[model samples]
Target chain A: MTDTENTPKQTALYDKHLEAGGKMVDFAGWEMPIHYGSQLEEHHQVRTDAGMFDVSHMVVVDFTGEDVKSFLRHLIANDVAKLKEPGKALYSCMLNEDGCVIDDLIVYYLSDIHYRMVINAATRDKDLAWITKQVENFSVDIAERDDLAMIAVQGPNARAKALGLLDAETAEKVDALKPFYAYPMGETFYARTGYTGEDGFEIMVPNEEAAELWDALKAAGIEPIGLGARDTLRLEAGMNLYGTDMDETTSPLISGLGWTVAWQPEDRDFIGRTALAKEKAAEKTQKFVGLVLEGRGVLRGHQKVITDNGSEGEITSGTFSPTLKKAVAMARVPVDIGDTCTVEIRGKQLKANVVKPMFVRNGKSLLEA
Target chain B: MSNIPDDLKYTKSHEWVRDNGNGTVTVGITDHAQELLGDIVFVELPEIDTEYGADDATGVLESVKAASDMYAPLTGEVTEVNEALDDAPETVNTDPYGEGWIFTMKLDSMEDLGELLTPEAYTEEAEA
Candidate 1:
């Protein structure tokens, strides 16, 4: 973290991003591309065809030990026991003692004793410290895989394009990979999971092999996407951004992530089980919902929302959704709020319709026309 | 470097001024400004016939990245606005200097143009 703070670090594909006409910007201490030429076009490219994103800035940490599963169950809010098979993956939120989310990550069960976890770049340092501290009584060794680079290939055609890069036998095996599953081939790891709602793969390769893979992807007619479209795509998919949608001050229950919390098997205790149980018993005061602007103007984060009954809320993550061709946002509002609300933008109140957080999936609008 | 038409005047806020030669002047964000703001998605233009002081924030140009305020180059009365921009704000990104013109205004005085920066001066500031 100290090293990343001095200057913006570059990913292994930095030159490739530059050659692809990427406009670099400082994102979480890394010089990452915001877009190649047009953010809108890159967004459409992903929703329509295949697009690749250099997500090497995200930290990949590996955990291995005799008690790995037990340690994970105690460290994270979700149950890792749900990963019953090798190569299975689970999405969970690591919570603090007060039941607030520390980070949301994906953990892939590689073997009986080894699990690989990918966390946000911005929360790298604290997440490591927290995970390490929780390993006190367990026999676990934590390793941050800095030598690995991650690339997410997404869209309807993403799987076929990615599979083409593998040998026939390997392609056949990966072709049969189920959702929420992963396969490790030699040094590279491929997961049939992604942040985008579209079907795709999040592949991890050696740092030295990243540019080669990126060139191959480009030659295969996969357009390179940037962080700008990545944000919009994830928002449309109803995926929560770590710092923007929820952080240490917010619990997953009130953040529209209650489904991620494993509350069954009451005896199975996790880090924040007590606090979360207390909150559940007390009843949630706020709820998360989606907002679609009824008129013109883009919805953006930090905008205030006023319910019909005068209760106020705030937009968490928002953007001009290219797929929907309208402004869409996720907001935390009064639990009893109705379907209609007003978003305050640039001193004017704009009406919005509230619905489920998800706006689009698989290049199709989920909202009724 | 962004294109700076030598025939036009500019402001430090990145608005370009074109002398229409009939006591009216056309204004829009400079190419450098549009490049910095990125893809423009919405434009909020001031109403026609509205009066504005020099350097007043007259309108807003919202891009996919963020929103920026377009300012008045000199004291003027808004005579007309580009209605096309209301539906196709992306013209600002594609043609910031031509079809992207935001509004036309009647200048309070022709002498006010002297206070605006020349193309060379603007280039120095924008490319610095």
Candidate 2:
């Protein structure tokens, strides 16, 4: 194989990942760490103590210029104007005309004239084109800033460890920011938002300075975690992934994203509003739930869930939860299904209890005793 | 390069077989296979009395990343299974050919062993 066609693109922290014994894999066209040594150990590390991740592959987009506030109001499903206080962030899904989710992103309202967003790396091209096309008439400029590198320091003790890496003055500025908020450190940005179900910070720094900060954090005992544990952690947290949980053909209504849609304004008719209304009235819309396997077997993606009523649904994402010591999965099933169902594995059908898509949060199992 | 024992026969699917001289053969995954699967969490071995044809999928092995089925190397009847793996699946990753032995099957015929790949053949095929 030639050098050019050899592998996917690497992030700025590629060296650091290698130095930490990370097993690199191609994920969404980006070379990312899947694990350092053992995925099970990494998963437990985040739950008990602290860990860090190289999330530089995600794209950062900035929307600036006049009337930016009004332009974003019609472009996205969530109400961007809800950020009455600057630095407040909103989680939203950018939908197509048919109410299908194009991508789910986090929007940081820095000001009325400027707003920033973090989009999934795999959906970068489509999301950027959609944003550029939607702002045709509005006086807003879409600038895709690829020069920034992102790192997520997550877990119960993550914030304290991250604070240890920075100087006193910088740490004090970060300590003042509340959850779901961000603080600008000159050109650097730090937000209290994360995919893992833990208290942590998602820091976006200049590309050149990413390695130094990662090394500094590593020195403080914040081990480098990988995408393998990242999946189980987010799945346990009940967070929806971009492609596995939902995609262009799937709606936020059936894909566990109905809450992100803004329906209050009554006048802010965003894209896909009509189709979303039709879906709300339809009885055939699929429902989302979590399946906790009660029998022997690991729940895997694309498995069929057979309800007691004889209806079936498909699993969107599934994995072995390290914390719970059981197989858990997110499934989209018929609305009339019961609180328990059978997951078809191999030639046998296994029993699994149905619950909210979340299994663990804040280092505690949410499942009832 | 992983450990490919000199005396054991190999399957292209990565299962290793050893003749116990009592007409029954012991079987487990090779070191190369376990390395690819990485820290196996679960293993599903066939029942003790189960009979299987050559190349039949007897059971499954699962890791954190994915799952794969284990295929029988020859026509045989399972005589015993590794009971220790029920609680400690990591044995497959730690000692794939020793304590991690999956099952022992009495071969229908000794001639069937000749059809499996030799160590030299398997090493060349796997390294390729």
Candidate 3:
């Protein structure tokens, strides 16, 4: 994954990244910035003030047809019927026949006949194919939005800073937007959604104007962050990375995403309903939990987890939390696991405190100090 | 380009060594190595008196992106490890050649210094 045989593709802000001294790396076959200079500094900037990210690599898919609502309800694990108001968003896992997650995505209810989804960058090819295959019985037209670019501005002052770029009326309308909702102001669509657990807007703009908007945001004092900080921020926010936390072979029920499953109105069977129902009824099932290392050395992915009850598990994702000044991890362990366990880091047994998956939100630590 | 001090010896694995004029020598990763590693968050050092063969893994350095093994530049016995790095691993990124010196070792043989790479040779290899 580190090297690429073919030339990697670049986004609309490629030149802008180079001007900012971004260190480019091959991410999901695209040339993306890993950091401008210091990842820790960029992370702290986003947590304390405001920072922007070029997230244009993620695919934006739009579905338009009379059957959009019904099609979505049958496509993803979440019940899209709950998206009653236009511009409302639902986070869901698109599962396969065996009730295993294919990709986790956000779907917006634009209208009864129109919907939009934003999926992970790495899963582009497979996700498109899967969605196309499933739309065979519905009257939906899947339109992949390749002509657009996405930029996320996040932090304590992100919203106000972003709003400063807009006209008064448009800014007022955007400011009134509820969380998980979006509104199109002129050519740009603003969503009150982000991955960094900070108050912000994820704006989708035309590719040709992306650089101008980026420069404007830079002039407004929002630092340009890279993928390095994005990973840590999302991890600290207790959100799951699709490929790392769960994949095609892992069910959402055991992936710490059980809350995303909408099991109401039982007659509306989604793609993985039967298998998921069976798993939900099963007596013994492993659970996804968070771990805070209580010893030296950084906890990392694939490290062995030994529960106090003699059960075993593995860390799905782990890193040294810059905010907490300690190592934190998300792991899959036996349901009977207790409050604490040991992690094997290079043949050393290090104790760790088990807690709810979330560690931080909106610039505040959820964990008790 | 990374700074390559004329007086120091180098290893292909990126460790730079300073001969202390005695049986002991100080060692740390090069500026090029630290730049490649990015924002280092944690570091693990070898215990004093631990012996290792030339090219053996001696310690661990972890950055936000990944973890890397710090190899011994020459066969020696560990004399001291930088305790300051226990709290400030970023020192390696900020000043790799000074206070960030990872450890000092008592050489098994002073003749081993002849096998090390000079500034010119190290510059060629590093740029290549």
Candidate 4:
């Protein structure tokens, strides 16, 4: 048996990847496709054209109860009451008692009693355990949907291609779906969401229909992208990977995710509000920033960042951006550090310019330097 | 994939050793190694005149994905290093067997070549 079979999981499109000659790699305990052929070409395709990714490995958890909204308001760091529209989605981080992030997720409000969440695959077990343990007091039902498969179609022409593959009724409903919005068709759920920083739709379908939908999308000229391109694309777009950028041990303020935290409604109580409020009041010591290597060499994860004062931080995630043609990295450094720093690459310190991330968005350069 | 010339010997770690007509050998990473690494971004070659054993780590290859240490295929004294890699590191991924050569060395002894695998044997080992 293959490694994927030995595990307790397999994505619906696993066989399709094998047929396309995908190079498989072990990612977060799941066997996943790294690339089909040239990872560089795959990266370019998503930046220029349309591409589809089988993100079924990510766990989808559903919640249903009369007190669902109240439960979420306390369980998440962000205020979910802001999602007034039925199909609107809210991006929030589930934090521990100490204000450290457990996992960042998107909560889709379907109705007063129904909601859905998408969590990272690597932290599936931890996230499920945490949620299950906390739901004991609430009259809520939590179900892990292993029977569903998620396919993300992304790029400049992603919406058009995805619309072509969907049924007429479903396509019409999704045609005007705004960003961060989702609606359910007969059996498939379509969300106007993506990680590549492009206009796209993420479709959640039954396991039996996933392969057919994937084949239809491919026939419609949507290229199949693997995890290799996914990483570079997200990095270029300034999106954070859960484990690499932050984890249960790191606070959102220091990991460049403070924007997702909602501190409004002062009377409202959330899981990590007290700790976060204290940290914010005291003026934290750490901050997140982007770094671009001014000289030669690729900046990668775990590389040390040196300031004029001394070594002040380390790279969280780094990659040679295909769109920018230069190495870009996200690093956590002391809040007092300046714009210029040096990255220790292979024992030699190379000068780097610190800047706000989002280097590329919508096929354009967002960085000035 | 290009044919691994019969004249050269290989190690399971993917290093190729070409026995120069003289008592020297040219060492470079194989094509399979470069392909797996995607794009070579940086390479750290050993200092010239350094003596290394057949199993010693003599160099390092940093690709866009990960970093790997290149081992000395045979005992030798490093005679020349590929300085061109300083600006054109992608040569290791484009032409790993030719201009991408890491370093040349004067062999300590030619008998150690017997321990290396033939092209066919090396290919099988890599596929495994």
**Among these predicted structures, which one has the highest DockQ?**
3
Q: In model 3, where do residues sit more than 4 Å from their true spots?
A: A1-5
Indicate whether candidate 1 or candidate 4 has the larger TM-score.
Answer: 1
DockQ of 4: 0.46
Question: DockQ values for all predictions?
Answer: 0.77, 0.69, 0.84, 0.46
What is the C-alpha lDDT profile of model 4 across A200-269, one tens digit per residue?
9889999999999889999999998999899999999999999899988898998898998888889888
Q: Which residue pairs clash in candidate 1?
A: none
CAPRI band for model 1: medium
Give the candidate order by descending TM-score: 1, 3, 2, 4
lDDT of each: 0.93, 0.91, 0.93, 0.88
Q: Residue A31 error for model 4, in Å?
A: 1.9
Q: Model 3: per-residue lDDT, tens digit, A85-201?
A: 888989999999999999999999888988989999999989999999999999999999989999999999999998998889989989999999999766688999999999899
Q: At residue B111, what lDDT does model 3 achieve? A: 87
Runs of candidate 1 with Cα error greater than 4 angstroms are none
Q: What DockQ was computed for model 3?
A: 0.84
In candidate 3, the second chain superimposes onto the true chain B with a TM-score of 0.98
Candidate 1: C-alpha RMSD to true structure equals: 1.0
Query: Which pairs clash inside model 4?
Result: none
lDDT of 2 at B60: 95
State the lDDT of candidate 2 residue by residue for A1-369, as single tens digits: 254265788889999988988889998788999998788888888898889999999999999999799888888899997998888999999999999999999999998899998999988878888888888899988888889999998999999999887779989989878999998888789899898898899999999999999988888888889999999999999999999999989989999889999998989989888898898888764898999999767998899999998988999999988889889999999988898999999868999999999999989999998
- Note the clash tally of each candidate: 0, 0, 0, 0
**Weakest lDDT window of 10 consecutive positions for candidate 2 chain A:** A1-10
